[model samples]
Target: MIRKLCIGGIGGVLCLLWGPSGFGLEPFAPRGELRIVDTSPLNWLSIALNVFERLIEIDIDGNLDPGLATGWRWIDDRTLEVTLRQSVVFHNGEAFDAETVRLNWEAYAGLRQPQMMGEFMNFKPGSRLEVVDPSTVRFRFPEPDGAALVKLGRLHMANRQFHEEHGWGEQQWGMLNKAGPWGTGPYRLMDGFSSSQKRSDRIVLEASRQYWAAKQSPRPQRLVFDNTLSRQEALQSINTAEGPVDLVSELRPVEAMSVAQSSFAEQATKRAALVTVFGQLNMRKAGSPWRDVRLRQAINLAVNRQELLGDIKGHGVIIPALAPEGAFGYDAAVTPYPFDPDKARQILQEAGYPDALMLELIAPEELQTQAISISMMLEQVGFTVDLQVLDAGAFQRQTRLKDVDHPPEQRTWDVALRSALDHLNFPPFLLYHDFALDGPSDWVGEEPELRRLYEEILRTVDREQQERLIRQMERHAHEQASFLYLYNPAQLYAVNKAVTFVLHATTLLPLVETSVTDAHWSVRKISGQEGASETRSAQADWNNAEQVALGEKVYVSFCAGCHGANLEGQPDWQKRLPLGNFPAPPHDETGHTWHHPDQWLFDIVKDGGQRFAPPRYRSAMPAYRDMLTDEEIWAVLAFIKSRWPSSIRAEQARVDARGQ
Candidate 1:
């Protein structure tokens, strides 16, 4: 016989068959809510909902894994075949087939706007994409692109049905007014998503019950991202025993170290990212000194990398070329220009600048300090540097001087400091995109050798030969001083000790496998028939005398370490550690525990430090979700509040009343 069971609160049922041996049924369990703070906007809410599907995803080691397309093979030097995953359904209920793939790529190619993904797809005006079958597609490129697979990893598929019905652009997914561009991912967007062009500061996503990998999807009931909190605010929240954030990522080096030893958080560091910083010169300007290679070299030589790196702390390393070590085309033999002011002066004098030469420098606001330091260094060798700082947006506009709409007179920036990722993980793409004639950022206009090397690198098929060509290209660019190479900064993040998190190579948060292990308050699944009668309601008041008496015993067992037996907290609680975190504070009237509402305190005890802090903030609080029952936690809160004098307790009651 088959037995059917329904899980209440959650709309789902499971079936079990009775055999001679036994019977079993799968049940849905509630995972606690998660709060995260990220420095960069990932359009994460949309990504979480699986509203779009990329062809490939990068693993933690920076290698590609199949995403939507299960397998791929090269048909020829310029032809490729992709085998799609079968029977996948978009969030909107549309079937994801080869035809869907065709429409999405076509839409991307036909869009009038230039896209970052377009560069990787290598789609041109007449490129051909043919549907070989319902589950397979073939792509024919105009030319052989060695990095084709790498580039396709970023090609996100939009549902063709939704696009056609909405009529494109204005009605496209991710727009503030649109409901979706449904995808085949593990989660779905819940209500209350606020959008912004710069970054969506608030987003909420819920795990999809209908997800294809439902059995393996993480236990998180919901994921929340808030980017509006300032560093100090996040830090403060993290130090609070019951603050609301769960994780903070992309922290600066100093901030990461400040709370490194705090009991509030655990620091996880990835020492390298496939990104670099560099300085580009305007070689196209008429009568410009940068047109002379020797002068550019002198400028590169004048700045002291060691001193500049010291200012950056432990964040980065100076290199001679744009490519980071281990990437294709990086040449170990090519080194950065040694800091020698006298040699730089001699080179500049030979290039006809016997006296001080004046030049303009443009840098983004975030890099203003370093730009100023470099300017001072350049001045020491007889160069007059006029520094101009702009917000990130304005700086990017200035860098796109080669665009047709930009006013010709406004392109007066002589030197621009910029940062970028080697997204394709190949050298020829960078050399061609930034320095070749008519290249995207062709500030250097044209270089015959670099162009020749790029074309040769493209034609070569052997990985060994290709790397050799890359080294030659790197050497050529360094010798020409194509760009003043800087360093690659380390990536950092801070996580709550309660949940396990493994970082991804492309920096995507791995939430699918996340779960509640030793948390203080694990959720209990309630059967539909017995839902209301199983246990006490989550909304019960915390002032019950009996519950308070029970809570006193629970607290002594679980929370008496850092909080002190008398609830006085650790000494010097206000003092911050070198890593930037504070000690545990008292729960009595002397501390600020009573300043929060009951719900806030409950969330802190349930979620721990990650719920209230930014991704970089550190803390020592461990979540009690797995260790304590709701009644027991309430009892503990009641016991603590009973210790407060009537005046303080009354004020806290008012705060809770206002919150309601």
Candidate 2:
């Protein structure tokens, strides 16, 4: 007889007992298909998340989780060794191993593939990958790279068969071929479903039965991504009872409000600070008012971010710079320019624009509402706005560098509305893409101080030093009014109440985790009596003199800035700051640092307090997982434990021993 056993405990796996053949096995139940709607013709993100797999995957809290590779370690400053997950196979049944990694690496090296961060993302010319074993590979770089993991995370690992048949990039094979582009992700593309058959075509994906993580396999048996309807039509369809669309990936404030009121669907929102919406000023344009720093500063002061937030139904954060809060280089101290139309007018008068300065503002159709709002705000403060709206395709062509030989004077628009993804949360990615000399969107021409700072950040592998340099760039950008800093939009999804979907910060639709609850089977929940807390090790090498010394250096460099030089922490550590966040707490015996286990302490330092804290919680502490090694984190913890009194240490050890 078929039986279901709720084995293990809370947060444990649910297994099925199939006629005594096995005690622990996946439940052979039919998981309903999910239908997702988007505005774009081809939802490449949906396909990428479903069909392809990256070397490393970044979670919602910006932690690097293993994807194809189980784990990775730095062999040295210039070398990195990655352990591949074994017994994995691609959709085409090709065994995934070190050789597959080598082939993917070779494909990247052979072709200058178009990437968001440009050529800097690629490995150095002399860099190479060595296959240490079937499931192990080592990457040797010519020089130390602070962005090795960040770069690796973006590299999608396709099989050798894909490369041999279609090569790299979606344009090469995505539309033309249907059976290929095989990947080892949890889902695979359904056969005979061409991505470019028509504008209304839908891409279908099926869950892979041979997936390595069988227990964590996709809940949805099939995923259908449809781009047939417009955003409004999609919203309308979802409001009705018989609509095929289970989820609308994105919705505006007005649409979201409607969805909230509708009985058929509910609104889901996430603080996705991945994409920053800002106005790109053509400062290099000859005789342009934007060339004057005062005018740029005036533009910033003119726009009322609060008003914009209201327009979006309070769905975004008013960012001080291009980078939002929690992102690298985002200094909380650097506040956004307050809305002051009088000051903006005064600044404009001082900059020789006593009368209204007439300028052209170009924007894509997608950002029409935002563009109009900004134009009206600027017009209120000694500015005459000539707004030019274009389709998405036309706007891309307009912003691109027409002639490399000629200066930026040929550019028509004074400012353009644009949004870019800070996917890695690394400041250098934005700096290199937008501000570097002759960069992709080099509207800001040459600036020596900014360039120098950016270069230093690129070279510096030390996280503390890089943070310092990046802050300097942020300050420089703010002072110079590099771009018209706006706000980071929150991703809003309208979903059917019957279906459950978890939103990702990266705006990726992870259908694997999505599921629909119907009459057949519902989501299983374990009893609260089954232990819910995680047990961690109480061990620490506090007695090691060398380790303590190294930890001390690390503490001084990274922690001392906010936590105090002597580990005394902030004066009012227990109390909340003006921003509603608690100040850095002390690591000494007087504080609660010793109350937690060694592994818990290590996790706090590695992942930061933001992940462990509640939603919308703010913390000044930055995650050091990318910057510091595992050994260094343990050493830092050891150093903290060494400072505590013996009695306090003993009590803390007891607490850890009890797994509290």
Candidate 3:
């Protein structure tokens, strides 16, 4: 009998017990424990350490794989249907069902300051993710979202009964001295802590027999997270053998290099730990000095990226950026800030600022990269940088605060460094955060045309239309100079030989797939040992990198003004050719980069993008071929690729196959 089921996915989501609850939790929890120095309840926004995952998990490729929601599909373009596994239970043995789903959203939705809501739609209690049945539910969006399934990864649904039974506040989840707020993950909570102003602490998860995912492979033997949240301590902990801490959140290239060369007991580099480090200037006030493009340019030119990179890291690191130049394209945009104090002086003078102005620079205390040096460099250009270092909680509070009076102009944060976790997907909804939407000042906010275009973006599901709209927004954002778009960072994490964890650009590490053992080495490291060809190919060519660095400087000296960063082509890479071919393909793996063999790759770096293309192309991608040696070109490419993920190389390979 074919039963036509009209199921709504988000509503159908459920968690319940599958197997009999007999021997409590078995010995199948994750033993591959790692330590993050700080895991604060307040750290909810910047980092949560993936406390729990729902049915659909976000994969390394930025795709959503089946998680708590074993299977999901679209009911209609405007709605989504999800089916939950029948036998899953929460950590506290509460039956996972439609009620649990409803409650989790209800709690999170009610909170005035939502940590997860901004990622997707601003979820409201009345925002209706209605339950359909015990095992089936539907997420009725206002419009279609193909990425709806993946979006579930961001939602760590909790046990409705457990949370309501307990309540929140000083007795809240992950508090100063306890671990509550249980979910249906592989591990059940044994104990926990909360977010604070000082140092961070850890939480322990015991194997859960009631957990639905545990039925698949009985979970891990044990899972322990020493959520320290301090990078320095995490780096130290990984060196110890079977200590309190095991894994660290972020390590710069220099740190990675230190691990690579150190005689530490256990160490490994978790791939793709990169993140974009950008300069976000608050452009709310109209007559405010930063509204000037010349001032923005001067601010950009004042900081030397090379020096900043050197300060950030020396090895296992890349300076040029990889993603987000145009979110959809393979554009490895490399915009180097020349160390020209004279030029900066001239530009500032020309902009009517003979002396640098006074401004407040807002940043988190932990970020130590060449990225933040932009503030110091701006000081050289005559700007007084009144540095305001705030804890994560205070920052989030102010950023989200609306009605409060920002004390005079002196107390407000003038510029900050921030990133959009999933900017490519939900664009216009977050425009207010950047553009002057609801502030006392009349800064850059949504205009009539922009709002209309954003509406079209929300309703228009056609992939092409979406891309055009995103590009339009990107163009608008760039022209507004709301942000300096410093550099999209490449993520990195060092692991001991004890565990294997997958990395994702969209989210942090997926601890569910990770496994820890006393194994001496992985097949990955064993195969790519020092003498092997794989190692040779993977071997970083820094001398060549040095050459590329030199050549890039030469290119920047002559080009960059028109060509854009590392030949990103221009702000308008889309509106390129009448012939349907771009004037300049991105230097990223997408552009015609993979089109040439190693020989031509060498030539173009030395020659320039202009030498080979026909007259009609008129590309601004100036020829570095004349300026650089063959090794330098390869080295420069190597530097750029260092920031790009392994997935891009595979795409480039396929591009090579097409012979375009």
Candidate 4:
């Protein structure tokens, strides 16, 4: 859309002004130089992997493709038709159609995305798409689909004249610090990274070459997002300060063995890992009604997945995954909340609220591991629990105000969330429709038979009759307790292999299936450019950039008051407001802290994000264990990898491989 691909490095300061007291890595893609990191950012409308496109993208391994509707049909069962794909385009060059998919489903069923992406809009957004002209399009659907390609694979086209010329409602599009590079895919965007103002902390995509469905991953001549907050401070501001993660999604197999004891420990690669950090339980928080289902199955048996495996390291952080563990029609004989508190105090007196029932719980105090282990397993069950901890912009303005009745200690926190539907594509549309309550409160779970078995698994592409109707809606969401299908989590990234990707697994995150040949290859030319790569070379990039500038002076003492002063978070994170509850999580690399694992990122910077989210509890995250130190939790994980992605310093030397 705005082409420019020279790629010749501005005379690399005369090669660092004649050097040897020297430092290295100077490729910066095809050339105009683009230091990567953004370990996150690019929420790109629910997830098609930030560079954008939808009408089916899927990946991580689930695979799917087509994005932007290249082909579709039906004309009946209520009509489908689709078509569009005439050399797709968007980053503003405009030109993709059906009135930009009916003005992005009339701005995703309007009310201006009140609680974000209109409950991740699984299509039918005020239904329509019609056009039947400019590259066709028809979709009708008053009903009777048989699940038209999983509801046109939860349709997504966007750019309806650029969200009606950027009027973006859903609370000014969840207060973005940046994003409008808009999709056509393959990649676009060039001038934005903290240009000092005009609100751009970072952004720089490249690879389009008139993209329509370009493949073989080859795109990267540049990508830099930089946004940063802490995946070890974006790998200590790109070691010597460069960026764009090669791999590093959410580390945790014992923090990938302290990056395999640093010095890029041969880019730690015990089987090239990726994806999984699981947790979710929006049980539709009917204000504070202890989410009834017998106090949500007595807070899922006061959880103790082996007390989070001595604080997370990888391989089955407790096994159990009632559903989400690797999500895909899941069904291991289900167990909504096993581990019993004497049947969780006999289901808290069969829901009559027995022995003591006072509740209040909210999380994301920046995920101190599910808000300090479910606030200590909801204070070991008997109830009377209270832990609010807001910050991600007042917990996304109290989950877009799904106030749900209120009362039990004046509402606002009852069952709490953990949902990890992980950008679902029919895992009961994020397992049991966000944990049902009744209907229309965004995030999900108002259950009209889990939204009619998510419209009977979207009328049916018949993947075994949509896995026998999503195993009868995950066994009616575990006999109507709604959600707690925990332990399907695992997404611990920590690569230092310099860069490579086909990075399979699918809860989203593929980086257009990454790759690289010369940003200075060696490590035997990156194990001969990929014949089984993972490769590394770091040696602790200058002691992780001086312990991430001494963990940004303890991240300006207690993380710039709820993650900001350049972390660009909170403010309205996603808008849960009124009194607040869950939105603030954008510590650059978008979030999940470079996916996590320097011992759960040094116990969440010495224990805070409500100490790894716990027992449906409260938190605004504070616990730096009497204020930081394990070398100040590896210098705030080297200031969260100085904000991530120079192939995550070669995915930290090919997953800390340290020769094997």
Candidate 5:
């Protein structure tokens, strides 16, 4: 049967930019702009995903909810039926139906580009989305996937009519506006917001008037995004009172604190984020020393997790596995490796490395401080460690195994620090992708046990049985010292208190539920209750002895690497060397840090000293915004200040008084 569904477009409606008015902001005609950081899809997928919609939408809590596909049900172990939502229209006046699903799934699968969305979702090969009726579709898979529903939650649907007409490209959406590919999402990309334009610094998204859902939060007249703006530049724009900026997207901890302390932003709020930071040891490469299970265990035992992750400001729970706490496969009983240098040494010696084992440690530029600390720890346990720090892009390419054409030497290091997970709920997916015998990263055909266990979990249909199987796999991997687990950093945002914004677990800003005047009123009503608790916590004296001890703990975890354990920084700290950057300076009296005020030091620690410096200035000191909390920052500062002589502290106290 041939079916032709036509969706009509609504007539033109005026767009009002909702700028901030007084406290009791009454909505006048739209006048303000929403400035967001749309840098890269990899770093900003949360925003891009919100800009588009899938058949089944995964909510902020990571549960499947109704989207283009109204609901779905498993027909059997390998077949599923999905009911589509009718009367939904794409931006191009195309009515959505079951064929829309089929066309989009096919096109997405055929796309030659390496999109983060595609890799993250892990679309099944040979699976087809077939039309059952005008409003229903069915999916037939070769094998039963434990995360089939989760995969469906990631299958974003697009208008077939639009894509066929315009053709495909990396920036197809950006190139064509209403005439190009479109989704039934809440926001529509405004025309002429392309990169080719002379003033193409921004990507504007106006609210969709043709949206089917009822309005919950008062809709923004228009949501303007500036993709070109850096974090530093965005903050500068928000600081201007009469500026067109109404909202500022993701801010680092230091930047948020800076905005809160200054007259620019009203308040900064923190939320728990769903991100993990860990180290992956490549068991595949035969040339790597970590091939021995005993050696891997020794390396894991040598790590002082407390000194590595403790005192981090907003870092949430520190665990042994990448899975979040209470997640399906996370086994709380399986403890993290303790800091035992002696045991590590004994294990290394027993593993046939009596004198010392040599290794290369790979890490991103952001994790240089961590790499340095890890190197020292391994050295203490009688391992000769050489740390290699690469920029984000280079680091990814060097560590990635290119399959048959890519040789062992190209795989670089034995161990590397990385922050990721393929599926948040399924540990088996991560294990399969990174370490299974035939996996890309697994250069050597090792870990038959992990492969066997992961395959078993994939075949298991029962949820309870799946979780139990996952737990068993995680334990086995831990016992083999497969991967060293680390802490999950908390997600945070700094916003103008005028706008009501909620940061979700996925860290995407809730644009649909956000309103300027409405958010202001809401904040005012809840301030008294939430404010009292905040006030009490903020009142803790950082100069006290207890606070100093707290700071010492924080400094050991984060600062001791570059700044030296005794607070005496790197050699030639003041010299601007080959990289056009100075080495990390001492925090003691001998250093110039005491010459500055408390707030000055705080800014340096939170945002990095290079942030406020010249435009292209570089620094090895990574921002501790999401990693460490404000209190922890103060504790670190207090610890540094305590080490200074009384004269230096008194001089800094006078310097701090000038700001008051």
Candidate 6:
């Protein structure tokens, strides 16, 4: 019939026959279309995990898994060779290969792209990719970097055409444009929707029929992410039989409770180990009492983390350090500071603050309750607390030295309550962004020991060695009371009972792995497990006996004078010589030579210590760049590495493979 039907109309009219459900629309089906409530219109979480693909994927337990690339190996300590998966094509019918990777890398290499983990997601400067063939590519770094694969895991791959049209990252609504959101994932951002319309309230995605993995086809034919609905409204929608919403993330405790009691919906919870809420003391502030170790310890002792968790109704674990449990380099031996107000007062007295000590504390506006609780605790410990809360934007600006309007010397806050996400589960990554000398924060001022330890950690890649170094750093931070260790927050999600969802420890919702049961539309159930995948080890270049023998001959001929014939150096090599430079260090297990990757060792030998040494740093070591060829330099390093114990050799090899 040619009759026009106006459905909740402002201006548009539809010419269609009315259906039983009304307006010719079918009833909401969880299996056919999945509606998720998101607070942000960008929907970055879904875009990163579902709409696009990376070179590698990290599982729930922080294990690296294959994604676009099938397998990888370390060509050298600074070069990673990856083999791309064949027969994979993008959503726009573009083939995925080495050229596709190169294009994506070129688009995002040096740009400070906005990411969930901040600017650390960008590849280090001077990092480049080389196409070995159509199916193979190699990544070459300026230096030996241990977090190469972890960084690659965050590189979202789009087709070459998409890169040319929209560029990389969220730049002035570029990613949200209607032209394309072309990717090589199970789903693709549905077109025909204007960027302005999508930015205002909603985004739509559809399952890709031509996705690479046929068996892992997306269950939902259509997916809608709407930000117009509030969490409360989303909860209400889920409780109804034919409501629009099927899933909601980041629910508050009260909302989770409501979902738990609802018959039509259920609540899913997991410990978000990657995100942490902690307090940073402004010990570097000029003439601040927090500079005193005793005062800092007193502050740590005053706060009751368990009580804070209880008050907030949080079901997360209290951490002893910034790093969470199960994360790489996390030490189980370290324990949280006990809550002792009396001890805190005593320490305050010992630190020459016998009377009430006045201090200023600042935190984000969202954490007002936490800030009040901490202030109360400090008040009980004979401290006069001046609590000032700022909005998220202002709080971020004040916390970062570069963004703050005031100069470093003019900063007046004594303590800042901050939150950080160690999404990679790697402590060194966090250290580089927050605690290093060149970091955004001024909390670690003139701390040579901490800076040195961080530098050493950056150069190391062996799991065991990195753990030892990180543990030492943790212990140092703990003993020094560098921060107010807090609990890891638990993330809660509300879901319609028809969907079977699994939660990851990293707080990533695996929508691709989710499924809907048509028979049980109101029966609630949740299940998940954590496991690590086996990683392949790289073959050591020093394994050849001929290379080792040749290396020994070269080492004795050119290096015997100062380094000793048996790989031993002069006594007291750790101490500086009279000329202000240290003597040659031993290459055996007793020295720190094996602590570095093979590339680092080769560079130090080939270019000599003088060129690589710090400014004005005296060095007795001579350059072999003119005397020795590249092969000779490599052979010498191989020979030196071959003399180490099997354990040391294995550790070095592990360091080498970290690049892959």
Which candidate has the top score in TM-score?
2
lDDT by residue for model 1 (492-536), tens: 677666656666544556566565444512233312222345343
Write the candidate numbers in order of decreasing TM-score: 2, 6, 1, 5, 3, 4
Clashes of each: 32, 0, 71, 146, 11, 0
What would the per-residue lDDT of candidate 6 be over residues 362-407, giving only the tens digit for each residue? 9986567788899999999988999999987788787788798977
Q: Which ten residues in a row have the lowest lDDT in candidate 3?
A: 534-543
TM-score of each: 0.68, 0.72, 0.59, 0.31, 0.65, 0.69
**Residue 30 lDDT, candidate 2, scale 0-100:** 26
What is residue 66's positional error in candidate 3, in angstroms?
Answer: 3.2
lDDT of 5 by residue, 416-448 (tens): 886653433455654444545455455435677
lDDT of all predictions, in order shown? 0.66, 0.73, 0.50, 0.50, 0.62, 0.70
Q: Which stretches of candidate 6 lie over 4 Å from their true place?
A: 1-30, 40-42, 110-126, 169-181, 191-198, 239-242, 435-437, 519-660
129: Cα error in model 5, Å: 3.7
* Candidate 5 lDDT for residue 513: 61
RMSD to native, candidate 2: 23.2
**Mind sharing the TM-score for model 3?**
0.59
RMSD of each: 15.6, 23.2, 25.5, 24.7, 22.8, 27.8
Off by over 4 Å in 2: 1-5, 8-13, 16-30, 114-117, 169-177, 192-200, 402-407, 430-432, 435-437, 462-465, 519-660
Residue 248's lDDT within candidate 3 is 60
Write model 2 residue lDDT over 1-660, tens digit each, in one string.
Answer: 556676677765677655544554563332556677866433564476667777788776555789889999877878889999886777555678898999888877776643534676777789899999999999998988877787787787777756765765633222324443378887776532434334336666666645667666777766776766678888888877534788897677767888867877889898855768889898777766677898899999999999988877898898887776667667888889899999999998998889988889999876788889999999999789999999876786767675334556867689898877666777777544554456677788787888888777767567678788888888888898989999988878898888878777667676666667752122222122125574443346789898889888777645664565678876668887544567668888778888887777887786667778875454546455533556788877778878888998898888777764
* Candidate number with greatest lDDT: 2
